[model samples]
Target chain A: MKIYIPNSAFLGNIDPFLRGFDPSDPGTLEITANEKWIAVHPAVLSMITALGLTVKPENISCRKLEARSRHYLVRMGLFRTLGISSDISIMEHEPAGRFIPITRIRTSEELSNFKNEMIPLLHLEPEQSRTIGYIVSELAWNVLEHSGSEHGAVLCAQYYKKSNSIRIGIADTGIGIRASINNSYSAETDLEALRLALKPGITGTTRREGGTEQNAGAGLFFIKSIAGINRDFFVIYSGDALYKLLKSPAARPRLHADPFDDRHSRAEGLPRWSGTVVGADITLDQTAGFSALLDAIRVTYRDAVRERLKARYRKPRFI
Target chain B: MRTIRLVEKTGAFAENKDVARALRVDELMPALERGEEVALDFTGVDAATQSFVHALISEALRRFGGGVLDRLLFKSCNEPVRKIIGIVTEYMQEGLAPGE
Candidate 1:
């Protein structure tokens, strides 16, 4: 496998970066970055780390990074995670109020601990902490409960001081959404599986209206709604399909049960990612009150379930 | 009525579903089966995930029906926690079978 890190790749223009990935050879990985500079979303790091884990560290090879900001990768714990030596030297400053170095979470206890430590590192207000913490919890838990990856979830986050927003990336090299959703429902394509996975009350675990006691299938919907309400970008990629929720207007936002209903873009037949990758941007400046967001979620969730049930209602046929 | 202090089990932010499941299967369900009312006291918890709330109570609602809510009480919940619990209960009931 080969991946090229371009000079700039965020949620907005990450498509080219993803399209550049080469998944032909699973036995080894070659990582190359643009010479001058490298700036990417946390999701990019997570994807690289997840792919690197599939093979032995010896099989992974990285080009000598000459980017002026190459130390950013070291600071983010990239080479350390893949067990490779970047040979880049830099002073390791405190991570507080800046970023969360790449971390691996394999168990529920690790995730709980990570949540407790994550909020304080960002130095956010109580409200902002709750929002960020909520996103991390739901996204990581989805990986733990459903991904079926032996290595679990690899994730990282960065606080963009310029935009006053937090960008998060999570990836796992497990069964993709199509396989997971197919456990209970039939989705013909990876894109269809992603659509079903994003809808409320739908889970790979069960087909019932309310999911199994453990999973309500509401995690992804809630995360997407948070991004939608904040008018930020949220992207999910599994298999060869990518669904991105574009930024909304500054006016009051309406949550949608169908992800495709939102202002979004999609791609099919891209480089196939065996696992799932999600990138979400939460612009703190536009964050709505968590309670108010919940109010909207309550109404939207109930209506989504009602609509699904209504769709199943039998019609009297008189011919 | 048996009151369970959630802060002792979940800390300030209650996002762990394992603890919720334990409280449900080991404490909440047993108490309900014995005909005792259970009050889930969230004196210090500020927020909770929907999955945690769902794991804690969805099974009881599924097994004993929506009327089980009458015997369950959520005490001292902050706004977000309260809203999460409300969402869980609302959806469970909305999706419950007529006789389930």
Candidate 2:
């Protein structure tokens, strides 16, 4: 399920009948505002506000105040209403504020136009913006590759100007994460598929170049680095298993690896996975080197085109 | 319609001296002179400095004179992208709220 269900009503305070996990014991399971909504459906993006939020884009404010679990959606709608260009970044009162809403558009042209319009809003430094763009470009392309059945996906973003943080979301009405994972490796369970995805080269594409780049897997790796330093977080859901990355040491790679050319066997464990809708939450930790982040992203803007190049040529000679 | 692009990729999100020149007179003057619908694309694009992106967007909207443009749309975006949009817009409305 998405972090949010569009048109969420009922004030979202109702207790939900959770599966797999129990929510009764507060001591055992710490329920944040997010957890409460996730219990109903993992895809819920929660917004906390005492009063209904007012969304301003360039001009007209929403005449009627409306509340949403995800303020991000409302944010975009207001942007559309006010007729702001894509180059503008929306700011929250605090570095991290809430209540966003976005409408799901149903066309590839529309998708392309929206992305082009919204890319400038990250409020990222020139460098950091590149990295964030790399992340967005990679994920957005994946949806096109994996979800060809659908015209395209709807994406929305939120940037915490104060926290110096941003989160980008892309969702499509196509195959979920499990199927994508299943296409790549022999994973009997959706959870297993999720685990395999976290590994460096477990891709479904038959050709080396065609598959998601090993370096591309590094996309998550680098995002993790930023989130780790800054205490940011990311999540991905595909198929049935929902995977949310907690920006902690357990989820990251060590500084050095033992160069196991032997390829004897993989590590003892992989990221835990379950069936989930495919979406990711990438949050930058507060302390990450903004320059490093920007530098890394800049290189991507210049070189990330390699992923696109790989798509051409039947042999897929290079990646 | 005014087109807004997420410029985190490169090229001033496509803003330039020509745009500055255009802005010196009226922000939309350049786009209008071209007889084009303003459109912004986030395709293969990335983040922009928040203030930078906001300022550009507001200026573009201002040029539209409240309704000359058809519509401003954000394309092929992700959740993180959506979140950033929310933060900026909410901030703008804060000061102008009727109660405030």
Candidate 3:
């Protein structure tokens, strides 16, 4: 396996970075980066850490990074997470209101603890904290419950000062969406599985309308709606398919049951990611009230269930 | 009626599904089964995830039918918590089988 860290890889232009990932040799991992500067979204680091964990420490090799901004990687704990030594020296500063380093959560307890500690570190407003907390909880829980990855979920976040937004990335080298959703639904392609996974009342655990008592199958939909209502970018990649909800231009963006129905872009036959990677950008400046967002969710969720039920309704026989 | 203080089980933010499940399987379900009304008091909880709310009440609705809502009381819920619970109940009812 091999990956190259480019100069810029935020959610908007992360496609080439993802496309460059080579998952050919699972036994060995090579990480190389540009020599000038290295700046990327938390999702990029999370993906590298997730992929690195799949190989033996001795088998993983990283080229000496000469980028002037190489310390950002060190600060983000990328090399430390992968168990490699970058041999770069830099002054350490307080991380408050800046970023969350690469952290691996393997249990529910860890996730709960992380959430408790995450808010203060970001120094966000009460409403903003709730939104971030909600996203991390839902995304990480999906990994813990369904990913089936031994290493669990790797996640990190950064508060972008310029955009006044929080960028988050979560990756897991476990069963991809196709495998998980196929447990109950017959989705033939990875993209189809993603479509079902995003829809309300659908889960890999069961085909029933309400899902199992534990999972309402509404987590992803809620997260997507949050991003849509805020007019931010949200991306999900599993196998060779990727769905990106493009940033909306409307003052009030409408939520869609089908992810493809939103202003979005997709790619098929890309380099396959064995697990799943999700990246979300939440612009705090324009965040909608959490309660107001729920009002919309309630309407869309009920409508989605009604549509599915109507689709299954039998037609009367003609005389 | 037996009242369960949720903040004691889950802190201000109730996102942990395990605690919700325990309260459901251990406390809520047993009390509902014994013909006692259960009031889930969220006196100090600020917010809750949809998953946690579903884990806590969706099963009771499934087993006892929608009538369970009549016996279950949500107390001291803030706006966000109330909305989350409302969403869960609405969707569960929408998905329930006919006559359930």
Best by DockQ: 1
Chain A, candidate 2, TM-score of: 0.51
In order, the Cα lDDT scores of the candidates are 0.93, 0.38, 0.92
User: Which is better, 1 or 3, measured by lDDT?
Assistant: 1
TM-score of chain B of each: 0.97, 0.48, 0.97
Residue B100 of model 1 has an lDDT of 91
lDDT of 3 by residue, A32-53 (tens): 9999999999999999999999
lDDT for position A183 in model 1: 98
lDDT, candidate 1, equals: 0.93
Q: What is the interface root-mean-square deviation of candidate 3?
A: 0.6
lDDT of 3 by residue, B48-88 (tens): 99999999999998888889999999999999999999999
Model 1, C-alpha of A135: deviation from truth (Å)? 0.6
Q: Which DockQ values do the candidates obtain, in the order shown? A: 0.90, 0.03, 0.88
B25-87 per-residue lDDT for model 1 (tens digits): 899999999989999999999989999999999998998889999999999998899999999
Cα error, candidate 3, residue B87 (Å): 0.6
Candidate 2, A155-238: lDDT as tens digits: 555655555556555555455555765665567755555555544323455323213211123333334334443444444444
Point out the higher-scoring one by DockQ: 1 or 2.
Answer: 1
Ranking by DockQ: 1, 3, 2
